[model samples]
Target chain A: MVRVHNLFLSSDGYGAGEGQSLERPFGHANPVELGAWAFGAASWPNRTDGAGTRGLEDYLVRDFHRNVGAEIMGRNKFSPCRGPWEDHPEWEGWWGEDTPFHTPVFVMTHYERPALTLTDTTFHFVSGTPEQVLERALEAADGKDVRLGGGPETIRQFLDAGLVDTLHAAVSPIELGGGSRLWTSPEELDDRYHHDVVPRPDGVVHHLFWRR
Target chain B: MVRVHNLFLSSDGYGAGEGQSLERPFGHANPVELGAWAFGAASWPNRTDGAGTRGLEDYLVRDFHRNVGAEIMGRNKFSPCRGPWEDHPEWEGWWGEDTPFHTPVFVMTHYERPALTLTDTTFHFVSGTPEQVLERALEAADGKDVRLGGGPETIRQFLDAGLVDTLHAAVSPIELGGGSRLWTSPEELDDRYHHDVVPRPDGVVHHLFWRR
Candidate 1:
């Protein structure tokens, strides 16, 4: 089953802002504020510094690592630069050598680049349709489930193609004035998926969608 | 404590649909589906029929009568006809004689008409700015909170003018492809209000906004 876990969006359903750059990966929006809930959750395995909040957010955050073998993300999520990567040849992504994915990470891009390995993660730039890329990710995952990481546009492509089986979106209280929108109306998902909404006391709404 | 209780919207933040007429008050949208949560809630006073479901939806529905003395709504909400009412001269409103609102109901419209009294509810058409109309509604509400009944545009006017102190919107899982939007980005409310999100398991996300 293909799943999207802990994808943060504004109250207006925007996944990311416009004109994203290296400094502002989420464009005009604040990534810190948009993802504050997950980072603050006690169940986050990546949090090694201080104690995090224990609640629904923590439970969801902790689920990010369960049974996930490979990740498929957009080129934009891999690098802020658009078009060709020749201009910023030295760029290795915002994660540097400490990329979060321990499994194979496939990046869908128009401009292909050599596979880059960092610690336990390997960034592979592959160009294909959502199905084609999913095939490669699934093969790389062996028997494990593949996670569809997104910057909104990539997730939208998968959603439009009906390739995703489950999606978990954390709707933050803030609204991004303009940017790429995930969906104009989520009710459209009702045709293929069953929707569940869990509201956290801290002002974040977790929207879960699973295939019916 | 001006509060908007049980206001239903699409996940995209649409309160009502475009080209709303007497035949379709919610335009292309289905009122039964958009407001199904409230109708099923056990606490809804309007539900005189059998029993309703108990839980958060019920609690919010019951809160509709808490301190609400009077109601303010747009002319569109009262009647389907726009511009001059001369074309649809006989249109009294879709609510018929026994309207749900038992309080003094004020309708803001350019076309002034005599007050129509129905049961405990009286529809009074008045023309003024949001603040001006709110003043009258507040006076009519007396010590109770004034409920800003809407069709999206009307609420947007009040929200833009900063007349609304608090708003509670239920974002249903369904999506209306086209309609009047309540807000471009609800985050703008952060300047004067604090926002909270509570998602019910029934696929409705309840957005609570209160004056800071």
Candidate 2:
């Protein structure tokens, strides 16, 4: 089964910033504190003797990383490039050489661009409906789990299609008064997502949900 | 200066997770990986020259620890305590004897609890409006910058009040499908935040945003 996982940051009640530039996206207060708490798990090398992190939070990060074979993200995540792809030719994979995603990354964009093959990962731009991208992702993932790495519209499309099976949501303690909304209402989800909370050493919370 | 900062993970759409419990709160994809990262960073004694950390991520961590005189968070952040004060009593800080917020932490809660004096830090619960909390935070912070520790609601209050002057939001590559929305559409602000993007060797984007 393809396990579609969506990740995001929480603003007070608004969608993310209008221009999701690399510089400022709702201005996170403490990136280090948040990062240490959120990603300070197994994926990165542990400076400590594997102490301090909550067991549950560590489990979720590992589960997502280990299970994910392929990822599909909207063009917004791939780059700040918008409008026709021809306008911005300098844009490439956000991660210069060593991207976190070692597997294949499918970018959902309207513009046509050549596939980018990096040292460990490749970026393939997919046009058309999100379903098309998911199809490509499934093919790329083979039997492994496919993650619907998103930018809101992309994940909503997947969720609307009833594609995601499991989701792990991290609720950071900060809110952007107004920018973006994760889910307008729970009804958007066809069925209830099993919910659980995983605490982190940095005082953040991770909410996990999976379809029954 | 009192520096209010917000830290949280993004759910593919800038929203935080919900029903944060012991099971899933912080975005830990893998348990083992999460453990290793936490342990490594927590093993502060072992971090020699911080050379082991990958690139900008290392700098971001170092910067977080280096800066900030004191830390402040909400009641939810201090402990998993719920309901009125009587419901949950005698709750010590989360880190036991050696809490990470070695600096002073001013927790905002309705119930009044005795101050917790730990080995390296002290926990004081302040019950009042956001302004009152800010005053106490400023006093506690003294000349040093005050870290606005989280639990979304609290951070939102501070941000809405325009208490945060500088924010360093590290946009991790992962996405959470659904949870708590950090920013919503209704809330609006006119302040301009400046940012500088620092790419970590690990592909994490460290965005440092400051208000001019």
Each prediction's TM-score versus the true structure: 0.51, 0.45
Worst-scoring 10-residue span by lDDT in model 1 chain B: B50-59
Kindly give the stretch of ten consecutive residues in candidate 2 chain A with the minimal lDDT sum.
A51-60
Candidate 1 CAPRI classification by DockQ: incorrect
What is the Cα-based lDDT of residue A170 in candidate 2? 57
lDDT of 2 by residue, A1-212 (tens): 45543254452322354545556532333334334444644334233455333223333454445556799887876876677766568777556777778889998878877899888788998798867778888889878878776665667677667777666555555655544355753334536554434444445555555564
Best by lDDT: 1
The digit string of per-residue lDDT tens for model 2 on B1-212 reads 45533243342423245465544444233223222322233123235453342211222343444457777787766765666666457667556686667688888988787888989899888788878887877777777778877755676677767777655544445555645434542113324554444443334444444544
Off by over 4 Å in 2: A4-6, A11-15, A25-36, A45-54, A184-190, A199-203, B1-212
- Top candidate by DockQ: 1
lDDT of each: 0.81, 0.57
